[model samples]
Target chain A: MDLVFFKIALALYLGASAGYLVFLLISSESRASVGFWCAVMGFVAHTLSIMHRAIFSGFFPLATSFDALSAFAWLLVGIFLLVRYHDPSPIFGSIVTPMASVLMIFGWTLVYQVTEPLIPVLRSTWLPVHVTLALAGNGVFAFMAIGGLMYLFQERLIKTKRLGRLHRLLPSLATLDTINRHGLPFGFFLLTLGIITGAFWASSVWGSYWTWDPKETWTLITWFVYAGMIHQRMVLGWRGKRAAVLAIIGFGLVMFSFVGVNALLGGHHAFQGANRFMPPSGL
Target chain B: MEIMVIGLNHSTAPVEIRERITFPGDHDGAVARMIGDVEGVEEAIVLSTCNRAEIVVTTKDVEESRERLIRTIGEIHGQDPSVFRSYLYVRHGADAVRHVFRVAASLDSMVLGEPQILGQVKEGYRRATKARTTGPILNRLMHRAFFTAKRVRTETGVGSAAVSVAYVAVELARKILGELRDKSILLVGAGEMAELAARHLNNQVDRPIVVVNRTYENACILAEELQGLPIRMEQLEQRLVQTDVVITSTGSCDPIIGKAMMKRVMRARRHCPIFLIDIAIPRDVEPDANEIDGVYLYNIDDLQAVVAENIGERRKEALSGERIVSEETEKFMHWTKTLDAAPTIVALKEKLEHIRATELARLNGKFADLDPAQREALESVTRQIINKIAHDPIVFLKRTGAHGKQNLYLDAVQRIFRLNGAADNQNEGEEL
Candidate 1:
């Protein structure tokens, strides 16, 4: 049933992504409503799938890379759809739903689906809290980066003097900039909390609060990059292309922290028990 | 009655001729009265904007109304009617309704999509109303024009983009900065285009404008005129961090704001986005200055290109506006047809009832042998049979009437039904 729900969600996301693409091309406001409802339905099915996984596994579904990415994608969709509800702009879906779809596809293709027994490090009560906050932080950055990309696209169109259909379809530079500003501080704060909570959990389990493990180091680096972005925004009121660039860079760092450290630079965070370049294989 | 529009717009007449044909504000009601006094004209409205002078009217005779409108307009402007006749373009029936819709939608303005024409039309309607020259047909047409204008405004981006370079600058600033309510503008030197941009910003942005020029005295003079604070050119570096938008039109030999100086300002401002409009010949701000983070620099060519692109987009949107005009014209024409159909349907029913009453009265004595209930049943059965026979012709007349062949269809229905006096009554009601 969980897999069935997941499949349905994946299909819906794919359809919604195409709808948004059409909306972007033609700049049709009514088609945006179609895309929005598709996202909403996909989100509902995605939630049911995640809930089913957690219930059957007797834990949150952050045990494997596939589980982590799928859950993160779900959260990202939730955040995006909620924001769009408050502000009805389909332009975000043009970028975000595709990103969600890609993440889900990657989860299915590259990561193992089987739930493994928890290691001593992952068995503590603090595990769920640390992982949830950490994943939530990445989810926020994902949305912010999408908004940043739209800002860059719109700014380029304006700068190049091409006020065409796509240009009109985009949200105003101010609106995109506003989203970046609000997202930066909120994502930064959550990332800070995640880092702090992880440190506490690590100290309790490993007898040290600070570790130079590759995953921890990269996550910290991701946190600092976002911290810098927030500082530049709040103290300097810095925004526009610069802020957008920083956001995209920060999200790239987040990707590296989530995937690169596990796959390329194995550390205590590795789930398959060793650093391997090959995809994890299991039902 | 027929709807007609007879006038000369910017496309049809020279500026001198258009200016001569306008109704002065003091004599706003005079032109309506003059057009209303013409024979065959039932209602008249005179809309005299800077680019066009139009006389919209409803009349019994379309050709006669057009001639009288041209003659009266010529007489009022102290020109020969023949001199103006060549410049006038006339539209009647459905074309006239479409013309009014397009004009109200700003599709017919000298600058397409300019919003003032809608307001001008509404003012014309007001003047016509006050003059008591607008009857039911004109009133309904004007209301639909207003609704069509609103629909065009919302359904398309027809009147949304800025067409002028100065307005484009303001539009870009608002796009980048979101709102200018608390933002500040720095006017670096002064030029006509730069001043126009500043004025446009001042109207929408509730912020104090700062003027800086190489000559302190000139800066002070412009500052006083614009109700802004004046600063010397040397102080530009000191005040650069506070400015959100900088319009530089200085006659400088080289760049005034270099990339290095902009970098320092960005660092101080913590990278708040600043839009720089360089309307200068040699460029007051270095082109490389725009490459920095949070700095957007648009020169005159860039701004003009943006305006050009927006105009193209507006033209594309105007296609949709034209479709809306056609749709509304069809709808309004159908409504007028229904107006004609209403009285015809009434006349047809009355004619059928008249025959039924005369025949029933003649049969009353013949059916007197039956009881009262039986007699009533017979009467109702005969009545239903007559109604059934009349239904098909009545429906056909209404359907055809709504398509504007009502006179032909009504005449045929009356002659076939042998209804006397009803057709004449319908024609009289239509003329009124």
Candidate 2:
């Protein structure tokens, strides 16, 4: 039943994403609303599917690498729905729906689907808190990155003397900049709390507050990059192309920390036994 | 009743004829009352905006109403009916309803998608209602026109783009800077073009507007008119840092603002975005200033190009608006056609009842020897027979009428029953 819901949710998200892309091409107000409702329905089903996994598995769906990816995608969709509920602009969905869908596909195809029992160190209440905060922070950063990317696209067209379709489809540059400006600090705050919770959980379980594991190291790097971007913006008035470029770079590091660090480098955080799930047939 | 419009718009009449035919705005209600009192006119409204003069009415005869309307317009303007005959355009029934909807939606406006026409039409409806010259048909038509206008506005982007150079500058500034409520504006000269741009900004930008000119006295006058501060031309460098948008339309032969000077200002302002509109003929700002990273400089031609592009887009959106108007018009026409069946149905029932009553009275004389219960039964049976006979024709009239074939069906039913006079006065109290 959980798998059925997951599959249905994936299909909805894909359809909604395609609808939003078509909306960008057509640029109709009614079509935008239609695409928006499709995304909202998909997000709702996706949430239920995640809840289904948690209820049946007897743990929060944040332990295995596959669970982590699914949880991250769920958080991304949740944030998007929240943003769109307030903003109601289809441009945000045009970027976020695809991102969440891609993450979901990766989780479904590459990782083991079976819900693993919580390993001893992962059984604490702090574990859920740490994972949820970290995933939420990643979701916020992804949203900010989308805003940054849009700002760059709009700015480039304006610079190139081409005020055409894309220029009209996208939101104003000020609105996109405001999103990045607010999302940066908010994401940083969540990441800070998540890091603190991880430290506390680590001390209680692993007998150390700091681990320097590959995942841990890359997460720190991602945090620093975003923190630096925020600092430059607030202190030195970094904006427009410079701020957008830095945000994209920061989001790149965030993606690496969330996905690449776990898949490529061995880490204690990889609780689903990554190599065992790897297909025997090489690419 | 029939709904009709006889009018002359920008396309049909020259300005001189339009002015002569237009009703005075203050006396619009009086004119509507006068038109309503005309023979065959049941309800009337006179919409006489600067660009068009139209008299819309619910009437008993389309051809008679058109003649009366044309003569009334000519009399009010003290001209002969022949002078206004060539410019007059007349439409009745569904075509008239569509015309009203199109006018309200701004699809039939002189400038397609202009916003003021909807408000002007509403004002006309208001005057008619105030004068007690609008009945159910005109009231319903005006309400539907409003709804269609709202639908077109939301479903299409017809009125969303700016179509003038000054308005384009404002739109572009809003796009770049989001809200201009907190952004200060600097007018580079007291020229007419610069003052026009400043006037456009007055309603939008709430911050102080600073006007500068070579002659300080002219600057002061323009500044006072704009409710802004007047500064000397030497203060241009100082104002550039403080202002977010600068509109330059000076009459100087050379470029007033140079690249090197803008580069210095960008550095001082920490590279914050600044919008520059050079609407001057020869261009007030140097073209090289456009190359600066933080400066957005649009010349007169560039602003005109954007306006032209936006106008083209609005025209495209107007096509969709036209579709919405047509769809709504069809629905309204169906409703009115269904309404047309009511009087015919009444007339048919009255004719059938008269025949049944006459036949029953004749039978009563022979049945008087029967008991009271038997007489009652006979009367009830005869009434049922009459109802059964009238039911099929009534249903057919209403059904066919809703498809806009009511006139043909109604004519046949009336001729077969010889009930034309019976329904004429009854329908006068109802809608068409």
lDDT of 2 by residue, A1-283 (tens): 5677777788888888888877777676676677677778887888888888888778877767777887788788888788777887678888778887898899889875687565555678887888888888888888888888998888877655566667867777888888888988999999989888888888887678887877778889888888898889988888877887887888888888777877788666565545454311000
Task: Write model 1 residue lDDT over A34-145, tens digit each, in one string.
Answer: 7778888999999998887777677766777887888888998888888877777677787778888999999888875665555455677777888888888888888788
Model 2 / residue B160 / CA error / Å: 1.9
Model 1 quality (TM-score): 0.76
**A266 Cα displacement, candidate 2 (Å):** 3.2
Q: Candidate 1, overall lDDT?
A: 0.81
Note the Cα lDDT for every prediction shown. Answer: 0.81, 0.81
Which docking band does candidate 1 fall into? acceptable
lDDT of 2 by residue, B47-140 (tens): 9788998989987778887887788877777899998799988999989999999999999888788999989999998889899898767877
| Fraction of native contacts (fnat) of each candidate | 0.56, 0.47
